[model samples]
Target: MSMNKEGRPTAAGAVTAIRTAALLPDEPLLFEIGDREHSGVDLPEVEIGEDRLGGFGRRTSLDLAGLTEPEAMRHYVRLSRLNMSIDAGMYPLGSCTMKHNPRLNERMARLPGFADVHPLQPVSTVQGALAVMQQLSDWLMTLTNTAAVALSPKAGAHGELLGMMAIKAAQEARGEGHRRVVLVPESAHGTNPATAAFLGYSVRSIDARADGTVDVEAVKAALGPDVAGIMLTNPNTCGLFEPQVIEIADAVHAAGGFFYCDGANFNAIMGVVRPGDLGIDAMHINLHKTFSTPHGGGGPGAGPVVLSEALAPFAPLPFLRRNGDGLELVEHVEGEALGRITAFHGQMGMYVRALTYMLSHGGDGLAQAAKDAVLNANYIKARLEGTFSAPFGGQPCMHEVLFDDSFLEGTGVTTLDFAKALIDEGFHPMTMYFPLVVHGAMLIEPTESESLQTLDRFCDVMLELASAARAGDAERFTAAPHAAPRRRLDETRAARQPVLKWEEAEGRAEAAE
Candidate 1:
């Protein structure tokens, strides 16, 4: 073994250092692990009668391969160790709110009553599940001080579409269908503008002031008879709260336009501030982020949209109702509701988890979680302020901290390079080049779940990396993660021309020959 300057073992004479050596040999693809003749299990052959056979019957052998029970178990366990998750270490992805998912929530979601109940079951059979949905809805509405909630949108972006559709429906009801423009702040979530455009509304860009919050005057100037509404994210993407939110909301309402608040950042102000009281007509709460459900990785997530009385009348249907008999779904748009958004009720498992989180914490506990999240973010900002450049320096951030790469100028190290280097330090990288308002953006959201010990360790690693960059040690960042299973990839080519499907190595070898 050869040691580098840091006394870490190096692979051969390469300048790069390997952090941790793999315990097992390099894992092969599943297809490569098993033979075509192998079968993992014994099964009885099925005999198809000519009368029962159809054109779908296979005439040739299938392409499936099999592994033994032990081999299959080991294969997955090794692959899992190669991936990063919230369980492995701290996930500091900003704006996405990749917080810890409580085991208690998972335990409750796995209960047979909650997990086994199908959406197509009889109403009376799944009364408990229906009650859970109603309870979750009530909790969300109470937290936001809104009149009603539609617990059917699949995720945050889906919830935005639902809210915008409600706004459009209300406008058309009042014969304002010509209000075709929606004002979105440049600092708003990327989904805000996409949702507006998807709803056939022209999106007008509202500029953010130097402080990273939307300017009230810019919003007023954009409001007109043709303006449908404004989609604003409170505690906006810069990790700073919109100070002029009330003024902007009042202006939009005064101009006969609704307010669609993107509730993606509700984790920072769950009990601290209510959007409804701020004159917001509609908002969507991401259960995965605010409440403690598993998020991302093709999630089974939920984004319930809470509506004000002005917009509640136009909310989507298939909502829960309490008749004289028991809790039942109003499967039709009986009253002033717009049509249904999803075919079935929303994600029941996510609903159970969110409600479990709420009941376990209660109102006061939820408020403290919000406070702690803000405190954690501010703690990070205070520690890394001098080493990194903060775009909005004077104010306290809500639940995340935003840093620009101005400090890295002339260091010959880019933001992407720095992020990749963090992987070699045995930690996941903070979100980079996001929220687009600032140049070379690096956003870090340390949710309230992390302890001081973990945070300090993470901060120390970041400071060390910063010092290396300033000292002109470009190799440390440029050739990073030599310990990982693979090395840096050509990101531009990967994004522009992705090979979505798997191709066998043997086919490639034959083609080359």
Candidate 2:
């Protein structure tokens, strides 16, 4: 509410408010703010002549721009201030697991030896770095209860490729290369099918039951002698653990097929359940997610894969081995090993950070973290299940809660509008319209990093927004994000004709130089 200079409160969704950002106001692009002729350093002018430039001689003045030291620094600082990070507030993105990155891990990752050591440095001088990798591998193997771990793959997708490659190699070595089909559940990550197809294997989709889980009978029906394996996410995208995962794995093995599990949701049951115990042949553990390394923004990811005894011999090369009281990096492919995945062993900084996180929180602490994560998600579900529509009833979730837009069917407010309106209340919207199994899906994961007070505030705002939508406040939902720097955009037009460059975004007034 605002006064109109008459000492009277205005109405809700009125035009009395202004759409200006409190921070980073009027921040322009580098081209818009820089001068075409200014510079921070003196440069000798180049002479332009036909002898020097030949057919590439200049026809028009080049619009090369420059900025002073202070201007360049402040421009980036302003843009950095506009970003929304997990450190700033609650980040409820579900399947991605955007949680807090501990500062202590950062401090350890920046230590002199760990930060400055080269991948090709002398093995004797960099024994500590190699030791870090070995220790991380040991922890991963112990937690997942697998026979071996390959730490060279870069990220989750890369690790999937490694796991699938191992499965393929194991089948070929035993003369079962005729298997060509890979079964992938719809609830699994999209990368699961892509990785299988990239490896020249046929992808077959498996159906999910009404409770948002895979049925063991469905897996049994899909299995055959030509089937290679099954790629499944245990705690699926619907935020419910696949109750028949063990049975599915056993059935797949009965048909001479491998089991590859996508470990993206290992954050939900890291210390509580082991994938190997469920008859999984190969699984990739996302160090960036479950182990608390840097995630998002093109950050480095370490996805070390754990292998069962059946597939351990086909693990990737560049593994560490003990050679009479000294550690040796086995770079050569010996008998049946898969070739190297990368030029080096793995991401060193990511290994350091993940190990630091593990050491800081012992076994009990990690188990508690998993429990608290599930607890927080269930708490949010219990609070919002009545206001919103949960596709899967009121059952307890793993580490996230999934909701659909059934509550706003006749209210004229869509799931997108509700998400956009959430921006007005100072919170990042939950992951929306995902998993593709439910209509207008909204998945929220409040990692154990959040406090009860923060959860209450988020829930209160959510309830208030639900109430507003139910009351037919169409204007509020339609024209939302009133407090952000920019207004709602023409999403369809933007996607069809994207402005990739600054000049293109501003309707370029200057011609090509």
Candidate 3:
């Protein structure tokens, strides 16, 4: 690989325009320094005639790049600086709650009891860890007011699959396995329909009302005996709460169906609304989103699905248990419990972090966090409504505010252009063109963590962009993000023609240069 002038890896195939090197000391592909007799570390003395790999290996030379220790360290350190991480600044991506992850939680997660435990350790030796699990479960039960919880799911989408599996198992046990239609609101998260459909259920979309909330009558009309369930997201993708959630749940249950609430938005209503009391049969709580756990690279998330009394019996197995004086985890063959979803206990690190966040923020603090999340969104809405167009302007939203491109009609600025322009203003862009119900949707969620001053500054930048759009400055909008580390890219081409590998060859650097 050749270091392009822009400091990115350059290859020969599908080459773009060549430019003079802008970044200094641009290195060539690592293969350029490979040698037959070079090695970085000393190897121990061993017999060369030993039959390793059963004589099926060593097809070619194990050539690798050689570099000094300092060069390697500096290379990685410089690359790390190029990344935009939550540790660097505020991450304002909507629908993804990126909040402040306390350093205390990190410290707790790294403790030997949590970080050094093996998945296959003896249950007796790991009783303390199991107790941690049990305690977390008790808190989850108390917080959601639910009967039971299954803690094996890996993430929000994986948890949705588990909730649907429980519903299916319950239906099969009742000899009503033919029910296969899942009613999903149009404004629900995209994964809701995909999860239901993947489980062989027909997805029927229900259009939201003009106010961005689900219409109770529409849901009632859609209910039938074949309905498996209704998957909905309260404080929906449009950031509006479905006030008729209880009625919708009742209608679905009356029709012999369960209610699967996508709890990804739980951060906006935690400790304020207990989903169990709201008639929800099952819901998944994204621990990473609401509890300030570090969201790894799209993974290592814990989504524990809480079940109502009616559905608790069908929860997954291998849950934590507490005896009179000791703690234990039930992982063996049990009676009629759904089998384990993961190989061992769920992500212990995430659990510890989530618990630490919850214990630090008691009941009132959580409620206030919910309240502040809503207040911040409304503040943004109120500040930007005059400049931008709100699709549903009359009522207050929950945690995020949705804007469409109606105000830019004659000015010709699109939602994508406006979002790209935010990158130039030293902020990550909001979610754009999602929730497909609203045209040119821009969903911005400023969690409870943002200060009033920061929010005002963001609003000022948004207003300036809105003014530019209103003044028909479409050229400036189209070529946006001029101040970012990189300029605007052809996203469509990048997605369609993905370059996913690196191979070593000669003349790669010269051709790229």
Candidate 4:
């Protein structure tokens, strides 16, 4: 076998490893597999061949990637071995809570009641699903201390947009439609300003104090009659709680603008702090992050937005409601609604899994879960302080710890290089070059699910990497992930001139073949 220039493995020569390879044969497309005289399965002859359309087009030839069923199965099994998942081991991607997706949650999601329900089913037929929504809603309301929940926004970014839309709607309703500027912190998630911009509002950057919290003075100066609101990530991206969150919210409210909280970091303060209580007008809870549902790689995710009383009336529709005898879904009719973000009640499977997780861990358990999450992050920070450079000197971190690349000053290793090395150690790299306020930011979020032993092992690897960097072995960091299926990539070139599809490279492959 050979590897592409980008280091993607090729299956040109060697067979893919699979236990039952003897039962399977590799695919040889179209002309090699199908014959005019042979068939794999026989079908009863039709009395009349139906023509769905006048013959504007008809198949002249069949082009298929042909393989026997067993071949296909084996091929997939071999491919699965090359992948890494949360099930494999610890995934320390900060901001992204790639924690365990317990089998119990999967089991409940697969139950026929939820798995088999159709969107067009009558209201009476799906009472159980509606009840689940209501139950989830109750938990969200109690957890965030919000007046209403909009269970339609699809993911974290989508939820951010939804919350902003509600804020916009409430503002417009109050004759403040000219409020067109949004203040986003320098350390906020990238999605915060993107959400505002998508809704046609001008985005203004807010500054962070030396302590890593949003500067209340900077926010105050940014507020005016034309300002719509502020998109703040409390337990801000640096993984430090915004001690001035209430004062910031009050500033926004005093300036006649709604406060929109980016609740992506809700995993850190889930049970401990309520966005509503902090005077947030609206916020979105990432179900995958806070409730422990699996996300990333183009997800099966849910980001339900929680609304304060002012914005609740303007929330998007297709929400669940219970009547006297039957459960009814309150969907906006045609020509209604500010907008319909997603169709037909969002992702039901994610809803089931998130609610299952919430139920298994009751309110108090969820609270303790958040506490443990903060504790784990602090543990990492405390243990690695001597080895790495933590930007915000010495305060207890929230759900994640942020370190700058300054510690590697004379070491000659960049954050990217260090992260690539982690892959070689059979561990996923922490989030790097994010929360742009920090130079070469390395954010590590060890969700509460990890045990102390696991944390210690991760710390050991990190310490070793730091020591190696200090030892001036720049080569070690540059060419990393050697033990994994792939190695370090030219990420800059990959991003700039991406080979988006395999078809684009097929001509070169065909020439070689």
- The numbered model that scores best in lDDT is 1
lDDT tens digits by residue: candidate 1, 1-513? 233344443323212112335573456655565544535653446886575455777788665545555556777887778888888898888987878899999899999999899989999999999999989888898899999999999999999999999999888889999999999999899999999999999999988899999999999999999999999999899999888899999999999999999999999998889888898999999999989899765258799999999988888888889978689998876565478889898899999999999999999999999999999999999999989999999899999999999999999999999999989887788889988999999999999989999889889999999999999999989988666776787899999998775466763453345
Q: Rank the candidates by TM-score, best first.
A: 1, 3, 2, 4
Q: Per-residue lDDT for 374-421 in model 3, tens only? A: 899899999999878898988888898999989878877788998888
lDDT of each: 0.86, 0.86, 0.82, 0.82
Error of 4 at 408 (Å): 1.1
Q: Which runs in model 4 stand beyond 4 Å of their true positions?
A: 1-53, 60-62, 297-299, 333-339, 504-513
Candidates 2 and 4 compared by lDDT, better number: 2
**Model 2 lDDT tens row, 69-99:** 5556777777767777787788898887877
Q: Which regions of candidate 2 are displaced past 4 Å?
A: 1-21, 35-40, 44-65, 335-337, 502-513
Winning model by TM-score: 1
Residue pairs with backbone overlap in model 2: none
Please, what's the RMSD in Å of model 3?
5.1
After TM-score superposition, the amount by which residue 428's alpha carbon in candidate 1 deviates from its true location, in angstroms, is: 1.5
Model 4: ten consecutive residues of lowest lDDT: 31-40
**What does the lDDT come to for candidate 1?**
0.86
Each candidate's root-mean-square deviation in Å? 7.7, 8.5, 5.1, 6.0
